[model samples]
Target: MTTELETQIAKYQKWRENLRVTLEAYQAWLEGHGHADIQRSLRIYDLVESLKSDRVILAFLGEFSRGKTELINAIFFSGYKQRLLPSDIGRTTMCPTEIFHDPSDEPYVRLLPIETRKSEESIGSLKDKPVEWVTIKLEVDSQEEMAKAMASLAEVKVVDVDEADKLNLLNDSEFVTTTVIKQSSGKVEIPCWRHALINFPHPLLKNGIVILDTPGLNALGTEPELTLSMIPSAHAVMFLLGLDSGVTKSDLEIWQQYIRDSVSRRIAVLNKVDLAWDELKDDAEINASVERQLDETATTLELSREHVIALSAQKALVARIRGDTALLAKSGIETFERMIADEIIPAKQQILRAAVAREIGGMLESSMASVRSQFEATTNELKSMSTLGDKNRDLAKKLLAKFEEDKARYGRHMESFNT
Candidate 1:
């Protein structure tokens, strides 16, 4: 049997690459034929690059241990044939993470120090300073080595209480007791990195799908960018909730604060549904109970039932790796995968196409207008010069004045562009 999941990703990537190639050609034409002014050309160039490198960023948001990372592992990294991102019990993804294809010299893990947050630089700017990042080289040939490298996401470093405050890692909340210490001496445990960027040659990511695996609300609260810029702009946001602990206080807070307003771009996942399933119980009864919880969650979050997906991410990962068709179907991942394939990805593609058309199309129109104006002015000058005597001299003077006027207009345009 063929995997529908693989085919969906392939189709999405095909559309994305086609658009990227067209944008690349458009950028080349603009550079070769368009205005030479640095500011004006650079503005168009930035948009073209954005169109070429654009990917559908799927932001997975939930509290700690809600199976956010596990769902990511099952949905994308299952090709590794083993657990790639650490999903073991008690392990938590402690920072905002971005996973995408690097297409560079090698696959590696780059971590930003938590201390860098004190600087004025944005996260995007800090990415250029490789020295400030703790880099880990990845071995693509061995799944075992890759798995080991993946575990670095869970690594943490202990520091004195004072140091944690200096890094702005300390926050007052009931759910934030984990970072505090009650020992005789003042000490605190905190994640060493503020963010992690994993650039791997994963098939899906290489085709243009970026996954943002975020930590709990406590961690997310500290990073304003996640709420203001990242999550708001994602193609889709999956908010995972534990089956046993449906819509807890912390989970609801994250949803209301960040995910609620973007209902059209969000999916509420009831993860670890296997824990609620039983062999002795009738299959119908088990399903009924799960449905009840799903309804309750949907009501609480004010989302439609279709937006809530109940799935066992762990089972799905295992089923995919072992090729267990029965378990795979039971895992509920197929339904979720279909939604992303048929709806989410295609919707994101339409948005990208519209953006390119709006920006690039505008620039093309502006360039054509400039050319048309120059042509008309030259044609008028030629007609006037054809007449004899004083007409020719008067036309020459008028042509010189026209030339000055055009130059001044062009200068004004360039001046506004520089600002």
Candidate 2:
């Protein structure tokens, strides 16, 4: 009863595991034979670890209320048979969040305080300081509990405007709201945290897949890491937009400003197709409308129709939960999921293969040069030792002949002097 998605996931998992083991053995062999240079060995080791740890990072980028989270839940978490991420109407993911799995760590939600942004520290460096982040242990057995814990990503803490500004969370009061506590107190405010990192035990994530669910342009613009590190390194980036809005000014700005230059494979998603579905009378009308939007969106983004996909993430989630195959097919998630599994994942595997080949090839070349140098030096020494007796005899004969010639010349000089 495994779906194509599940089958592909399993296949990738097997491939990675096999690759890791094979590389580990090769590294051991090279180490034992003393053929591995430190630098080359380290590079090979790092590639092996990367192959083991690297996730097929699928980053979902869009503005608020564009169904970015809903799309994520539909594509990744529908197996829970309910909404895993907080995708309600008003709630928004205020900061950049990365959902991934590290088998070494426990399942928890780690929120980096906005105050830490005042200092010069990357998120990676700050991960070890448990006191600076708020950690919440997750009950992986229950989907509802995990859902409640994940809802905290949208939670805001009330702080003075000055404090919010100092934390760099306040940007012209757009992300925060002004409030009055009482007659005595003046204005109060709530500031969203800077960023969120959630570690979980999801199957896809455990198989080395990371999902970057980014919302709001303001947050994306503020987080330089998103543009410089996360987005650029991701294997795939999906820009989600609603069909009703087509390509809005904000969407265009986000695309042109940040996403357009990304090296990752790009896809323009026209989500919330269910809204467009309701007005159509028949199948023909539905197909015509869907095709029209697809064409229009592709034109707006200056991409081909193949790169533009239209789907209803909400309906897809519902269909998945209810086990409605027909509805799931109509949701268009299967087509997109298939594209990811068959095309993107396989392509990533090929990329990894090339990287492995390059790293191992370098290591082998270095080792071969060292081995050849040692063999040539040893060969010259052995040849010199093997000819040592012959060389000594030849030197004696030459020295004897030179001595007889010098004696004959000395006798002639003495006789001439006597005469």
Candidate 3:
């Protein structure tokens, strides 16, 4: 069955494909009609390419263990019949991870070493230098191999406190003690990678949907690139919170500092609602408890109640893998997916439409003006030739001269326009 998100993405992809075809046709027309100047052709080419490679980036933001990664797995990767990313208890995803499909490259996991943080280069810049990253090829045919490669997302290494501090993985105070683990060897544990990029060929990802799964507050606070560039660039941000914990201080801090005002669309995901399900209570009572938490979360986050969603990502994944329709519906994942399909995807389409109109609209207008000018010139020349049939030889010669002059002027105008 086609999911709502998949259906919307299919529509979006079709729309984009149609637009690309139209632009390509326009470019061919310009070439056929001698209007295809280098500058004009290049502009059209760039626009077409942009449409071809366009992506909708949705970033998930929250503190550690909020089910951010789990929600991602349930929503997008449940088809594998297993958890695709590491979402175990206690800080699994330690660095920012981007999951998208790029057919130009084979399936692979690329990790940038944490030690690279010592350099002034940003993650965006480092991505251009392949040598700077550790590449792990994914065996897409084997689920076990793929899972093993993906487990590297949670890979951590023991380092001295001084090294951890230098890498910005440790704090100077109580936050450090709470967040980082100290070994008996007097060494601190830190993430093995500074950033991770997964180029997998998932269906939705292939249709130009990019998912960014961000780490908790400690990583967000330390990585300026994430808070400064990545989060702000996302089309929408899903701010996940554990229903059991409600809104923690760190979650609120992440919202205020990194999420709020960073993106145009924000969804406060109250994950793990199954925790509130009591067998002793009826359906109404269970719903009432979930609603109360949703209200509280919305009020605390200063978001509308509609924007706050409650779901059990773990249960959803289990139900999906087991093909249990009742459990799937009860998990509330469908509701959340519907919101993405109905709201976020359409919003992205509108933005794309406005941008394309702003860009291609002007070129179209200019082409129309040029066509109109040529039509007028042709009409006048035909009128002159008709009049010449009844005129004397002297008048005919003068009219011919006028025709020559007009043709020359038109040629000059077209040359200037093309340039």
Candidate 4:
């Protein structure tokens, strides 16, 4: 029941893998031939491999309770109660969270606990916290299965693994006894509990796509993996908003200072439209008001009005899951979905996607020169009396075709996000 978008992403990933195998084969052949021309082909193959694994990471960032989770809901979920990011206002996600695909030869959400590390001997500890990192191996396949992995990360509590032995409740040696540990009258020391360790063999992410759902920038004392690793590596950033709140000074500050600085493409989304529109007249009027606000805000930021997408994350998430666009709009979700297509997805296409591009581009300029050189040599050869003209014509045709094909394939890899 996967949608066209999912299938398209799958196809592109498969194509990339096929190309990788082909390029590897070419490289192997070039090694056997040991000619200067063959070396050029090997280099071209290496370039293709780089392009295939050319990752485009998308990071979600905002303040607590800013509907960052709801925006994730709109993008990743597709059903009734389409809830991806936890939407609790009071308990607004306290830890760093992540949801991504992992297509290992043996796939599992290798949940690396904060205090532990995976090793052959045993779970080891780092800084007097507990033993080291041990991955919580969870098996999964489809999207629904992936949700379980995220939920497991959310549900688990942190306890001292050594303390678990005292309770005689030691089910697994790798299990760390989770606790809120010690509390100082005002300040408290709680045993750290992690959010999630999700891994899946999703077609989109395997070739190099990682989508992150963060609890804004203000979260404390949780895992540092998010800010240190994920954020810095992301190719794009999605900034969510609430329609009731609109664009605030804090939002502007974060955008101008942090998110905009790191990510080349930033998407500003207005969520919770259902609540805001309920207070307005007709749908058109509600939309008009949002447009007006979008313009005012974008102008202040010196960003294009198109950059601020007016959406109901709550609605779009539900609609996509139910495959009901009418219901999505009725629920105020259509706006989010449309915004994703118009702004975020297209930006991905323009930035990272190039069909046979990265490798070919590298080879295009370099290989063509060699091809021409070889062609001249053939023309000058006395043995080419009957074959010189044909060989030269063939090389010329191939050289022109290479670049021509690259230009035509510009957006093929982008089709996954294009919708």
Per-model C-alpha lDDT, please?
A: 0.80, 0.77, 0.87, 0.53
Q: Lowest-lDDT window of 10 residues in candidate 2?
A: 175-184
- In model 3, the runs with Cα more than 4 Å from the true position are 176-179, 380-419
What is the clash tally of candidate 2?
A: 1
lDDT of 3 by residue, 172-212 (tens): 77663433567767698888888999999988999999999
Cα deviation at 396, candidate 2, in Å, is: 34
Q: How far is candidate 4 from the true structure (C-alpha RMSD, Å)?
A: 10.6
Q: TM-score rank, highest first?
A: 3, 2, 1, 4
Better of 1 and 4 by TM-score: 1
Q: What is the C-alpha RMSD of each candidate to the true structure, in Å?
A: 7.5, 13.6, 4.5, 10.6
lDDT of 1 by residue, 1-419 (tens): 34465577678777766766665554555465456567656766676678567787889999889999999998887788888988767547877899999786488888888888778787877788888899889898888888887887877777788777777667765456433333336776787778999998877787778999998877777877778888888889999999999999989988989888854588889999999888789989999999999999999998988999999999999998998989989999999988888888778778877887776677767766775676577657655555545656776767767766766665554444322
- Candidate 1 vs candidate 3: the TM-score winner is 3
- Give me candidate 1's TM-score against the actual structure: 0.80
Model 1 vs truth, CA RMSD: 7.5
What TM-score does candidate 3 reach? 0.90
Please provide TM-scores, in order, for all candidate models, with all chains considered together.
0.80, 0.81, 0.90, 0.66
User: Which of the two, 1 or 3, has more lDDT?
Assistant: 3
Q: Candidate 2 clashing pairs?
A: 55-208
